[model samples]
Target: MEELTLTTPALLFSAISLIMLAYTNRFLAYAAIIRNLSDKYLKHQDASVLRQIKNLRLRIQLTRYMQIAGISSLLFCVLTMFLIYIHYPIVAVWAFGLGLVLLILSLLFLIWEIQISAKSLQHHLGDIENHFKK
Candidate 1:
């Protein structure tokens, strides 16, 4: 393997930071949606509202997992850099590989969450369509 430099792991720092920021934004948006939906359901008790609540719950869970994975990747990247600093190239490579895998997993979960979010939006649009048909 090519020599592992501190710069190698450092490269992921900015990317991971950006990803974590995106994840946080998604999480905040979900939280706002859930709270608003909850208040609406309390007042109206609509079935469609219940369905939306369920869907948001699942999306929230997926977002949590994605955030967890991203955090793990960041932690591992830092560990890899520390290992490299200490002159442990072999273990550092392994840590770096694990970090990459975690990053990929986070991205996959993010994609899944986005798909669910789109479907939820479509459900809302279906309601609008039904209302217009009346």
Candidate 2:
């Protein structure tokens, strides 16, 4: 087997670490929003607020799944880099490929959660419009 170049694995590991950090930040933001919504629900028990809280909970759950996937991918990327350092090209390639796939899956989940959030906002807007019409 040919000797591995440290630069290649180093760069890959850095990218993976950055992506995981972003994913974690996103999860933290969602969690904060959920907490805020819960606080609002406790202050006033409106049906619309209740619905929004439910939607937010669901979105948070989805985000949690994405966070899990992103973390898993990051782990795989680290393992791949280690393998590459040891000149195990085949296993390294497989691990890197799997990590790539997991990253893609996480992005897809993020997209879905965004769509759900948009829909929830739209529903709230419709309710506001109806209230103003009365």
TM-score per model over all chains: 0.96, 0.80
Model 1 lDDT tens row, 55-94? 8889989989999999999999999999998989899999
Q: Tens digit of lDDT per residue, candidate 2, span 14-91?
A: 766776677677678777877887888789877866777778788878878888887778777788888887888888
Residue pairs in candidate 1 whose N, alpha carbon or C atoms collide under 3 angstroms: none
Q: Which parts of model 2 are misplaced by more than 4 Å?
A: 1-18
**Alpha carbon lDDT of each predicted model:** 0.92, 0.78
Report clashes for each candidate as comma-separated counts.
0, 0
**In terms of lDDT, which candidate is strongest?**
1
